[model samples]
Target chain A: MVALSPDLTGLRTPALRRFLTPGLVALLVLASLWSLSSGAAGLGPGQLLAALTGDGLSARDEVVLYQIRLPRLAMGIAVGAALAVSGALLQGLFRNPLADPGIVGVGAGAGLGAVLAIVLGGLLPAGVLAVTGSHLVPLAAAFGGWVTTLLLYRIATAGGQTRVTTLLLAGIALAALAGAATGVLVYLADDRQLRDLTFWGMGSLAGATWGKLAAALPLIALVLLMMPFLARALNTLALGEAQAAHMGIDVQRMKRRAILSAAAATGAAVAVSGGIGFVGIVVPHLLRQADGPDHRRLLPRAALLGAALLVLADLLSRSIVAPAELPIGIITALLGAPVFLWILLSQPSAARG
Target chain B: MLQIDDLKVTLGGRDILHGISLQVRPGEVVAICGPNGAGKSTLLRAALGEVPAQGRVTLNGQDLRQGKPQALARLRAVLPQDTQAAFPFTVAEIVAMGQDAGDFAPEPGLVRRALAEVGLDHLADASIQTLSGGERQRAHLARALAQVWQPVGPQGARWLFLDEPVASLDLGHQLFVMRLMRRYADAGGGVVAVMHDLNLTAMFADRIAFVIGGRIAACGPPDAVLDPGLLERAYGCRIAMNTAPASGPWFVPQAAQAG
Candidate 1:
């Protein structure tokens, strides 16, 4: 049987896109508010608004608003947007929708780095290794992530061509190595460090603070801004490297830039949020269904939807068990696994290859 | 005019196109016809500066190798075989990609006209991923059309390099695309197309270049180059030729052959 034609008339206009994006942004703001107000020490919308806008609120409410919920919300939005944009860029670069930051080993490497910091903090002097020093863990994580990404990139590229299969295989190899190192570090951890390592490995927004958000925000913003400029180049690249070259794009240069940018964004995200799973994998696919596969639309929309999904997931993680919070990664996996299964089951015949 | 002089392309220390030379004048449609691995596509790629080649290609007396990418892009465009839209771009957007929007901005009306020229105006808003094989080929042809649509300069010619532009197309679309190429040449453009179908080549091509192995075996008008002897030498088969009522000569390969 012949496939039915897609109805594209409604989405062909840039004006419609302009209108819809702002509307989605407004919905995201409302969702953020609902998340901030509905926590254990529940603040009413009015009290939350008063705290947010500097009107009037109790000291306890002010502390909850400023200290707990605000930073977590910011981290959720920043990490969510970063992962989604990086995933979208990697997918385009590989021309495979299944490519994600986690699959490429950046997350594993960052997690290993953070775990090592926790384990080693127990042995070192207080001045040399301070766990609460704001920048220590993130700095180490970023360094580890960058090293892994560079190594994988070098192994995959030979004579200026990146083989997708080789890249994936190398990523798997590196991830396994990183995972083994992480296991060894966990085995060597002391009691206090063990608890910290376990909690961080499971992933959380519980320790979110203004300092962490400040470190993550600029990297996410840089990635988002760089992504839109690459829309045309990415569209050409999807046709394959030879075709992209014929259309005047410097394919090797574009691939290098895209990989570095995606690595930086993913590294910063994992450093701050402790490896939130599946937002990168799921958000782009979901956005593709609504915005079509045009990266110009898909990239920005994926960022927004990812931000919204993570915010909602954070809300569920905090509220599902009341006073004791569940890990945010657990919530994302629970929500993402079913959708992933659906996509696997519902694969279009033409997309099989 | 497009001139290719002693072009030799090597890939991985193996020569793919060996010392090929050809010239196409303004208002001419030249067809390169050969067997599957005769390096027809390589010749076109070499001329378009897509492949690393030893010799020179000049368009209107300007060296294509020395020209900047933007300058060369404005001078020519290509439509390759097996056109696939890996992303879900709209038909109009795919066509607009051919032209540099900075120098030759995408006018909606012009995109519509280019699509209409390929009988694809109705599919302008259609998703490129959703189109059939023939529809997608036509959309790519529209893209090439848009690329070469600038006003004639003092040189008065633009070139189009097509590699098997109609191999996957149906007969109707094949003829449609050939007719469009002929129209472009009639309007003082130069088109160098690599074709597998000899009958279509005989009908539309002003000149034919028959390639064998990695070199041009014969080059002339269709009647001179597409003789039975050259077909046997290039394709390694004896063939019978008959004239089509509406088109031109058609060849039927013999049942078996030993090279």
Candidate 2:
């Protein structure tokens, strides 16, 4: 269906795009507050605001707010945004709407690496294996993510070009391999290591700290800053490699940069949050439906929508069981899958392929 | 302004184009006509550097051997057959992509004018994916038009390489695209198009090249190159040619009677 043109004169000069940004920003603000205030401590909105502003709160409340909820909320937002942006980039690169970092094995690869680190930690000295103190696990996870990305890239490319079907197939194969590796590590873990691995695999923001946030923030910021400039190039590329080359895109260079950025962002997110699923795949599709498929707009909108979705998911994960918490990954899968199915079913048959 | 010398292309251990040579001056429309698998598309791809080939291609006397991608893109634009609206770009955005590599800033008015030339201006804001095949072809032509550059040093003429530019188009759109190419040539641009429709080639091509089995069998004006002998030899099944009142010859394929 054709989009109706917005009136471009007078007050609507910036048009529908202006309205969407503020609306999404407001939703994100509300979701962030809900994430912070709706947990076990259950501070009211006013107290939450007071704790945030350092206005009127006791020492215990201050510690809980600053040391716990704030970091968790920040991690949720950053990881969610990173995953969504990476998904948008991959979808553009593959020219397939179904593409996501998780589907491409980046998340599973990172998860496998982190599980391996945990399993191997028992063999090392206690001083070297301190889980929270050492950056070794994240480093290993990032390496695993990048290696898997390279493998997928090579398999997908043939005759100096990439094909979407080949890329998807390669991604599925690697994802299965990583999953099997993760399963073996889980099977072999001791009681304590198994507990740690299970909790991490369930996808928590509970481990968020200033140090972890510091590690992830710069990478996310760099990707976000660079990805919008590539929107026009990606749009051209969707026409196919031949046309994109004719348009002077240097299609191979563009694909390399896009894939590298996607891997880095996805790896960083997995390192911080531990295998959060569905946000990457669903957020971009939802935003594309709402705002149409201009990646310039879609990228930023997906970032915001993703952050909001994760914060909302986190809220439900904490509150649905009251004293007991559901795993955030379970919550996202339950919610995101139905929405994704609805979108797919709603599209006409011609548009689906 | 554009010359190809002894061009040869090999792909997948198979030689697809063998020692083909031709030239097109400014304001000339050269149509390469051939049957299926006769290397017409291969020749156009070779010219655009989309496929590897052994040859010398000179644009206004500048050697295009090992030409940098950016330089080639600035000097020529290609429209291949079987274009799909694979993305959701607006028509205007797709057209603007043609100017992405060049030094010249694209004028929006030029985009509108190009779309108008193909009678697609009203759909400029529409999503490209929603267009029909004919409309999408016109949009591609508009994109090529936007890429047309006047060399700053006065050394080269812009060339458009089209492979089956009008295949699968309705009669009107077929005529429209060919006429647009003719007008582009008349404006001092060079055009080398691969066409399957011999009638259209006869009507508009300044010269015709008939290719058979990866080789150019004949190259000359339509009247000289499209005679019965070449037609029967290249196609293996053809009958008669009729001269049109204003255009040129029209070939009718005859069914062989069972013995």
Segments in model 2 whose C-alpha atoms lie over 4 Å from true places = A1-14, A51-54, A117-135, A156-169, A187-195, A342-353, B58-66, B99-106, B149-155, B256-259
CAPRI classification of candidate 1: acceptable
Q: Give the TM-score of candidate 1.
A: 0.87
The i-RMS of every model, in angstroms, reads 2.7, 3.8
**True interface contacts reproduced by each model, as a fraction?**
0.34, 0.41
Candidate 1 residues A196-290, lDDT tens each? 77666667888788987886666677788788777778887766666666666766678777876777677778878888877887988776655
Task: Name the Cα RMSD for model 1.
Answer: 4.1
Report the C-alpha lDDT of model 2 over A124-189, residue by residue, as the tens digit: 677776753456566567667767877876787564445555766788899999999889889999
Clash pairs of candidate 1?
none
What does candidate 2 score on TM? 0.89
Cα misplacement distance, residue B144 of candidate 1 (Å): 2.5
Q: Over 4 Å off in model 1, which ranges?
A: A1-19, A113-171, A185-196, A345-353, B49-53, B58-68, B99-102, B151-156, B242-250, B254-259
